[model samples]
Target: MDIQTILQELELLSTERTKKTYIRNGAHEPLFGVATGAMKPLAKKLKKNQGIAEELYATGNYDAMYLAGMIADPSAMSEADFDRWMGTAYFYMISDYIVAVTLAETDIAQAVSDKWIASGKELFMSAGYSCYCWLLGNRKDEEFDQEKLNKMLEIVEKTIHNSPNRAKYAMNNFVTTVGISYMPLHERAVAVANAIGKVEVSSVKTKCNVPLASEAIQKAVDKGQLGFKRKNVRC
Candidate 1:
């Protein structure tokens, strides 16, 4: 895709009343997190395009700032660059997006993991959890380790269960993205429900609503076979 074209499209999309409602109503924070996660590569491409980057930064939208951070080159960026980009330009932006992009782009996962664990920011932790899950899920393995998978599921479950009201939406976005069609998602959902003292499995259904996997998940659950043990994890 043409990065500039996509950025422009997103800019226009963000201007619509429907989109503006999210910002006006304070839902823009979490929405921007999701957008940042999905648009990192696009942001990197735009960073090299000075005109587009300037326009985006000039707009001062939280989403634009988060996207700019996603595209920033850490290797070439100085502490001064971070100070100016983060402190001066987009003061309204969340620090979570900065941490997320840093972890996502850097090769040093352990270092990022340590930093996030120490920071104890929910959004950053959620982002780290997601990035690690993606890394583990995509790795080449002769057999899937149920223990490790269960641990990952537990992490997501705990996040959703313990999330504050303001961050619940953000947690949901993370769960939906990580859980999209993975059979482990069903177990995670159950754990989340049990942890939070609710019976709402609808979130899982909603996440997979597009391809209609709810029925299949229900059937599997009914058969006493719906945990991470199932082989058909990928959708």
Candidate 2:
């Protein structure tokens, strides 16, 4: 219900080993080493409380910031709140997942995505690409601007290989997300991914490899997972 209470809960969930691992993955101190799975039940209990969510994010605690995303009412949050969150985020997961998901749920998604991608900040640009990924995956064709989307694909084609590490990774994920989820864009997205080939994202802690976008989408197609729209981006 409050920052102290949630922080305490998260603290109890922290483990020294996980803390060390998280630090290597780009998270800093003041974060409890709580697993994301552990945060979900807590987030569910605090769901839809924008005020509490804001307080949690302002704590600058990684676990709490991620919790804020789970509880946020994206529709209720003002654009100013998102702006603050995006600009202040100190971790990749906060920017790429929490901030991106909230932005996708709002009407200003594409506008902010464009603005952030154009910025010099790596975090903002990564978040922007991540937001676009969610936007393209969850929204219907009628709701999207074909011109802008087309332009984004072109930008990826031209700049993805030279993008900042996380930005390149996010862009690749965006390609797979669109190619796998949007039927009409599948061919184009695959073409772009094939042309870009394997992407490299620097990760110090995780074994997670950046999948070739084309192969990832192709796997989805093989499993008949293509063309499935996610009703919500939170998952």
Candidate 1 lDDT over residue span 1-235, tens digit each: 4545655656543445544554653444423323433565566545545344434544555566555555545555443443344333221124334434444444564345445433455444544554444333343333335555556456645665455332344344333333433454445644453454331222412432122223334454566653322231121
Please name the candidate that would achieve the greatest TM-score relative to the true structure: 2
Residue 43's lDDT in candidate 1:
60
lDDT of 2 by residue, 1-235 (tens): 6689889998998888887878877889788788888888888777689889889888888888888898888898776778899877887788988999888999888888888899857889899989988887788877876667667888988998778878888888888887887777788889998999877766554545578998999899899898778887895
Measured on C-alpha atoms, candidate 1 has an lDDT of 0.44
Instruction: Kindly report which residue stretches of model 1 are placed more than 4 angstroms away from their true locations once superposed.
Output: 1-19, 25-60, 74-102, 133-160, 166-235
TM-score of candidate 2 relative to the true fold: 0.92
Q: How does candidate 2 score on lDDT? A: 0.84
TM-score of each: 0.44, 0.92
